[model samples]
Target: MRAIELKNVSKIYKNGVKALAGVSLTVKQGEFIAVMGQSGSGKSTLLQIAGLLDDCTSGQIIINGNGVSRLNKNVLADIRMKSLGFVFQSFHLDTHLKAYENIMVPMLINAEYKNKSAMKERAIQLAETVGLTNRIEHYPGELSGGEQQRVAIARALANNPDFILADEPTGNLDSKNEIIIFEELKRLSISGKGVLVVSHNDAVKDYADRVLTMKDGILEHTDEK
Candidate 1:
């Protein structure tokens, strides 16, 4: 029953350009929702707002039934850290860290792990979940595009969050890797994680429970597949 809900959300930049207009959505646990659109169509903006990485200019955001529109930055930060996981198109792994080390980054500040040993164990488990056990000690520079993305996915799962918000998660990969990433995401949703993916690829439709299209700052249509 846990869900992130956006009620009539709108975002307008300081330059007077509107990125979203009266958009409303709900992403619940065990659901895979894909938002597809052309570039500049506000899909990324929608994901950022939903993930609490950016605030909407107007309207309400509710996470797990608690309204978060008025919460302070620190509280919002805590909620984001504990409740949501994020994966980006650009694998944001630290260049200086090994694959397992990168996965452990999020657990460093989390209250769940009391010591480094526990964090490392969880990181190893996550690496295994993403099929990166053999590459856990490798650096990002040493991995292929698919491998780096797998590392990013492992890092996102490090905190054991309820929801995963991914923005163009397979943008840098070829077709094979794209399918791999999508399958991983679909598997995560089946494992009881709410997944919202913003992607340009139509292949995502094959794996999504629902597909929403964005056009010119509006949610143009929704197709339940």
Candidate 2:
């Protein structure tokens, strides 16, 4: 399935700074795509627009067949909750919540997981999948950076999203942990989920099925492993 399609997408700030300019990209199911660029290169902007966390200044965002560039905020929120998953450079976990509880957040908001007990069970399963089985009861601060990132990965998969959008997901990790995380994402893609990663980390190229380079707000074809 076509997970996401960005057609002539552009994003211009109010001050007239164009973060993205006529950028187009496509991500399909079971594909792992990596985007590389330096700071201020619009890599993050492209991710935000694609994930529906922000809107494009001009053009269309087709996510899983629905054009969402023009969708209302509520509709966009629904799509975000149901179809897309996100991981960030900073593991954005709630400080006080336990690892498994953090994973349950999305489930709580999702209509399908109305039963609290079932939601917790699913969260535990995700935690195990991310190698956090024993740490499921720990808080974010109690975990190491890698462990926290793993929890973040589990949380991202909580809603069983069609695509996972990761923005510099391994920016804070050590070399060893970076490999671990990248391998996990690669495995996720192999299992049929679309994974889009925007990172400057060289380690990512080894695991990506396709790598794209963004320069000065435009995406250019690039080499991959």
Q: Which lDDT tens digits does candidate 2 get at residues 23-138?
A: 99999989999999899999999999999988789999998888886678998999999889999989999998999999999999888778899999999999999898899999
The C-alpha stretches of model 2 lying farther than 4 A from their native spots are none
* Residue-wise C-alpha lDDT for candidate 1, range 85-161, written one tens digit per residue: 99999998899999999999999988777899989988999999999889999999999999999999989888888
Clashing pairs in 1: none
Worst 10 residues of 2 by lDDT: 216-225
Model 2 lDDT at residue 154: 90
Clashes of each: 0, 0
